[model samples]
Target: MYSDDELRPVSALQHFMFCPRRAALIYLEGLWSENRFTAEGRLLHRRVHDARRGEKRPGVRVARGLEIRSYRHGLVGKADVVEFHSSSPGQSPQVTIVEYKRGRPKPALDEPFHVQLCAQALCLEEMLGRGVSDGAIFFGRANRRVEVPLDTALREKTLAAIAALHELIGAGRTPAARYQARCRRCSLLHLCLPKALRPRATAARYLALATQPPAPDDA
Candidate 1:
């Protein structure tokens, strides 16, 4: 049974998207190692996440590390930053989930970050009982916010991803590796060594056949 804590971190989507084996190793088998990139990312998030106070800038208000949960999707996580805007002080505010990324947009979908933002929007919608309008992905390098609409298609895709994530995590086995261009950028290359291990499996099969006794021939 998954505890509430297990169900609750946005980081799980990151693992589920990155590699099922990696997710299982960390979440289930209790393995964790921090690389320099991860360390720096953590340092950047620390100050942003630690900010409990809200800052006002004209019509917008920025709140950091806000707790978020989505009963509809059975997901929970914290938003890096949520911006709120209102017509007046007493009026209900419009919420936007702005995810802070340490890197620029990649050719491939940053599934982890995308999924995280979707989860945040889901949570906000549930809490507000009103549909969320839009969200944004803020890249530190670019120093800009790319607005993302919470449209029907994106919502459906996010839900599907969550379902897939749940299935992958529940399964105890890791997926077999296949090389792709993305493998070069993978942080787990040293740990995975997919290419190195492939030939070894083939060699083991050949060696086993060589040692096997011949079967009796039928006349």
Candidate 2:
């Protein structure tokens, strides 16, 4: 188990899954840049997080900006919303975590979102001492919600991601960038300079070359 000081943000899982080098850049190297995509996402999260009050419905209770954490996995973060649905009068309510996103759903590119939701569910379970069978991601552009099962496979994947995140942060090394189609959407594209640097060289190696002394000429 990791100490409180050792815990990393749950959001890092999404970053790590999206691109390890990107994750290292943001979390390890403290690098960040804003683009339309990131700005929109931040706006959506800000709106959700600003609503700090909980509302009660007939059979459900909705809480916004719920802070959650998992000591077992050394993860900590906030959920956009967590709705508790009551089945009976006195029994514990079934938990459903809701995450708000700014764009439409893209199944091909949404694994990171699912992993993020799963991490939220894991943290919720630990916090509430209850089982979180499923969660949902609400897409603003799509105006729809996609349900995600917190099954063993997804839980295992989330745990593995948390482990990888911790390892990456502990290593304190930014991964070498390998340019890809998705790099265009990355906010750190300019900072990463994936295209300028050779894929085989580490960021440290590239920087070293930039500052190295001129080579001696052969006589």
Among all candidates shown, the one with the greatest TM-score:
2
Question: Taking the tens digit of each residue's C-alpha lDDT, what string does model 1 give over 55-163?
Answer: 8989989889888876556677788888888766677888888888777777376766776677778878887888777798887766777887777777787777778
Per residue, candidate 2 scores C-alpha lDDT tens digits across 1-219 of 779998788888899999999999998889887777777899999988887578888988899999998888898999999998988777888889999989999999999999999998988988888799969999988889999888999889888888888989999999887889998778777677776587576778767655554322200
Question: Could you report the Cα RMSD, in angstroms, for every candidate shown?
Answer: 9.9, 7.3
Q: Which ten residues in a row have the lowest lDDT in candidate 1?
A: 210-219
lDDT of each: 0.71, 0.86
For residue 145, what is the lDDT in candidate 1?
A: 75
Candidate 1 to truth, TM: 0.79
* TM-score of every candidate: 0.79, 0.89
Clashing pairs in 1: none
Count of clashing pairs, candidate 2: 0
